[model samples]
Target: MFDKFLSIDEEKRQRVINAALKVFAQKGYQAASTNEIAREAGISKGLLFHYFTSKKDLYLYLYDYAVKLITETIEQFVDPEERDYFERLKQIAQVKLSVLNDHPDLLGFQKTIFFEDSAEVSAELKARSKEIAETAYYRLFADIDKSKFRPDIDADRAINVILWALEGMGEAERARHRALGIDLDIPYMMEEFDRYLELFKTSFYK
Candidate 1:
């Protein structure tokens, strides 16, 4: 289905994807209008269908593309030698932010997709969400050096707590930004992550 899309100029292909992403992020699969997407991409509705047969197909295609993009980005920038859990996480966040620079709607759209209640896409999203949860976080900490943690501390528990804190902080940041009608600044958020991680290390490190 994407063969025709692939044959197009790279910039044009991305324009379509970005246009679809913006609409999907705001309206989700059930309510997103292909007419709106085509207009946003500066193409006709007929051309959009020529590229993607249906709204469902477009949503799934974009979902797969976004997931692959982020997974590849993380794999490239997250170093295996960075055994410090917090440092590795910081590196991962930075790389994710870099990706967000080009694909502004990706992260938010993904978050929405995972929790999307539409029956049309719920099963697929649930499966992908499970697959990601099983592989991603487990791999990140699989070879972490536990000795750096205090001898009295439970290493796994400490790692879990840190992960929870980071996730909470991210959600809070998104919520705050939404409430204030401000755009998310990746560097600003990274700085906040650094401050929290440093304080956490002071308390937890040997």
Candidate 2:
């Protein structure tokens, strides 16, 4: 579907992707302008549309591209032999930090999609997001060593609880920063995340 876009030189393709990511992350699907994206990419709107048939198509393509890139990066960096659950989660978070260091706008674009409410792409986004989440949960957690967990507790349910709690903590922190009209403090966020992981480890580990 994106053969034409893929055929472009890497630098030009990245420019387009970065421009679209910035526009969509900021203005979201409903209000983001293709003209703005084109201008940022140093291309005409006609050329942008030539690569992507429509705005919706471009937005969805960006989402898929971002997910694939991030997923691959995580798989590459995270140690598969680390069977401890909390340690695995910590490694995944560190991999994300590395990805953000390289592609600053990618995380913001993904967060925007997570909270996207635009009628134009919300349904499709929701379905894709659900599928991605399930696949990620299975891939990341399914192989973790169960023996580290408390013997009396169900490790599966305990893992679910820990995931939900950490997710809620992340959402709350994002909301707090959004309310303050400031960019996220990644270092501080990581520190807090580590603290939460320690707490969870104390509770769940034998």
Candidate 3:
């Protein structure tokens, strides 16, 4: 689907991708301007369109690219053999933080996609988000050591609750950082996340 974009030299392709990610992350879908993306990429609008037929195409392509990159990075770093659920989650979080630090714009673009309400792409984004969430849940949790969970508790339910709590916490943290106009403080965020994991472990573990 992106043969033209993929065929370009790596440096040029990355420039376009980085520029588009920055614009979309900063201004969001509806407000993001192709002209600005082109300017930032050091290319003309016509050339940008030559690679991507429309802004929607470029946005969706970036979504797929960012998700694939992040997922692959996590798979590379996370220990598949570790069966302790909380420990695995912590490892995954660490991997994600490292990726975010390396590609801040990619993470920002993903965050924008999460809250995007644009009519042009909202439905598709929601569908894609659901698919990704389902896949991630299975891949990340399916092999966990359920025996460690409290015998009185439903392991599946407890796992879902833990995931939901952590997800809500993440959203709240991001909102707070955005409200303050500050970059994510990785150490502080990880410390708080660890505290939450300890609480969940106490509640759910045997």
Candidate 4:
């Protein structure tokens, strides 16, 4: 019953969703109120409920929507002609990084939701997220040729390894800073991103 908003035009609905993202990210799910989201969107509180039944419903919808948004953003640059693993991997990484760059709120909203997750929260969101993730995994791996990856490398393991590396880049840098009590000397993130893609290319495809 809780389908993601596929038919809705983002241009029309984004005012609300984008506003809700900020409210939810800042206040967290428990503390965030619909009035706050409505105020942020400059809409009447009465109108907010017209779009969604409750804060939980809206957050769940946004969570599902986020998974789709992320994949669709990545799909735009995944050219079939760019079959070289490095070329393909670079494009994919660019896609992911660009999505994060443009929609930075998703990271915080997601962190809050994941931290607050429980059986009391919507199970549909959890199931849908898993389904979306599995589909993304299949789509990504389908683009790769088994012969290109290291013969000893487990396909699933390799995918998880790369995914974790992407997640760790910023956090690892922050951790280093905190441990030493010094400023970050991290190079340009995009350049690090480029270097990472090259590493995957050289290690796996070359």
For candidate 1, which ten residues in a row score worst on lDDT?
Answer: 107-116
lDDT of 1: 0.82
Per-candidate Cα lDDT values, in order, are 0.82, 0.86, 0.88, 0.70
lDDT of 1 by residue, 55-123 (tens): 988998988888779878898778889988878878877877778677758866764664466888888
Candidate 1 lands at a TM-score of 0.70
Better-scoring candidate (TM-score), 1 or 4: 1
By TM-score, the best candidate is: 2
RMSD of each: 4.1, 2.4, 2.7, 5.0
- Residue 151, model 3: Cα distance from true site in angstroms: 1.6
Badly placed stretches (over 4 Å) of model 3 are: 170-189
Best-to-worst order by lDDT is: 3, 2, 1, 4
Model 1's C-alpha root-mean-square deviation from the true structure amounts to 4.1
Residue 161 of model 4 has an lDDT of 70
Better model by lDDT: candidate 3 vs candidate 4: 3
- In model 3, how large is the Cα lDDT of residue 126? 71
> 37-83 in candidate 3: lDDT tens per residue?
99999999999999999999999999889888888998888998999
Q: Residue 141 error for model 1, in Å?
A: 2.7
